[model samples]
Target: MTSLPEDPSPMLNEADRDTAVQRLQQAYAEGHIPHEDLDERLHQILTARTRADLVSPLASFPEEEDAGTAFTIAAAGGRIKRQGAWRVPRTLKVESAYARVHLDLSRAVIEHPVIDIELQLGTGKAKITAPRDAIVDFEDLHTGWKDTLYKPPRRSVSGGPTIRISGTMGYGRLKIRHARR
Candidate 1:
């Protein structure tokens, strides 16, 4: 990991670099990095040559220790539901087969502005109920199921966490819904 000078005027281009810089800024705002270190990292990000170069500067950023709170529900042939008030981690992985899984994030205590949901299902139903203000991104999810109730966001939205849904839905139904409030 090569170091760079702290100069705001450093040259930058690629979109990935921009996103990395924004993540660093978010971490700094969360007090994960001090002012001096952030400035140095920001400079490195600005002048980074490859994606791997940008990654090194962010390696020191603190990861959420609350990942243990992430809800991982695997049902072979039953109903699995995560409702009521719960802690929403930075990543939520769900694996289901011949079962029904429901994730209720309306009353969840979200600790980040971005959440990743990895879904792997087979011949079952998986439903995610989140707050109406949430920005659900399921563009990368490909399901062989014909009756999916997911409605991909038509436009960009903010003011809430961006729920990124990925992985395979298998021969199951996946739905992205909102809480009734």
Candidate 2:
């Protein structure tokens, strides 16, 4: 094995990388960093070499509360849509009774390896477009009338995050699809 003389710091293991990623997500959840910052830091965390190199990626966030943040989006009678470089929280709860909800993550910045979305909807359609390599799970979802429309990817992407969905839909359709590469 070859070693660099200028840097003798120990290399990072998978566990170290995972921890750093968690810290980054927590920071974003607490509003310490924006979506763009999270994207950059996520790339840095995933590509860092040594433990010392992890500093800059996990630098900004301080523990404000005991837990990370969860977002709740509620709508009444119109359409709820999010797309184009939006921020995705670690946990999201979408509530609606008569609104068309659309969440497009194909161009969003997602740093965490897992995101949970809970939906409570009635009489409105919901559509979600995930990243090209993401894995979406609707196993915990229950629909009142129509079934959810989701087709799994033909091949899985290694290291891709999992999007878990759990909720109750009433007389509305839930559509989940992946982005084109």
Candidate 3:
């Protein structure tokens, strides 16, 4: 079964942080927190490395939820593409059979710093186009005839989402590349 990352930080996307910020602003407007405290909390929320870091600041506010949740795509002898301003989930499961899977995250909303992509491909191709600053990890991928057109990051990166791609492929190909600026 495909699963979430060991740490849930990757699940807290920019929208989540923005929600927390709005909550903080609301609290400040209502005099729930002092100006100094609000400023400090906002800083923390902006630089939060993990979801837990946003909890304390947003403790008094109700959690802002997104129903989009985990994004799942399945293609059976068809093609699938993800692009534009769609919300990114902590976990993404993609299954393709004699089809093509295209994931473009250049302008997509990213929730987690370490996004996990579970791919189940068969006689197909999975192509992912990510931001230039983003990193692609395929160490756990189990496939046949793998081809990557871009230079993979050497190590885990900060400030941008790191896509961790993994899964089974039968006579399929996987490609990870940076989006054209």
Q: Top TM-score: which candidate number?
A: 2
**Model 1 residue 108 lDDT?**
91
- Summarize candidate 1's per-residue lDDT along 43-123 as a digit string, tens digits: 888888766577677887665354446667676878878888788878888887777888888899887888999888877
Lowest lDDT 10-residue stretch of candidate 1? 1-10
Whole-model Cα lDDT per candidate?
0.75, 0.83, 0.75
Residues 93-166, model 3: lDDT tens digits: 98877888889998998755678888888887778888777877888888777654455554544567788888
Cα deviation of 47, candidate 1, in Å: 28
| TM-score of candidate 1 versus the correct structure, residues matched by position | 0.59
Worst 10 residues of 2 by lDDT: 1-10
What's the C-alpha lDDT at position 7 in model 1? 45
Q: What is candidate 2's lDDT per residue for 1-181, written digit by digit as tens?
A: 1111344359887877786787788678657899989898999989998977877887767543323568999988799899999888888999988999999988998867888999999888999998879888899999999999996667776656799999999998999998876
Ranked by TM-score, top first: 2, 3, 1
TM-scores, each model vs. reference: 0.59, 0.65, 0.61
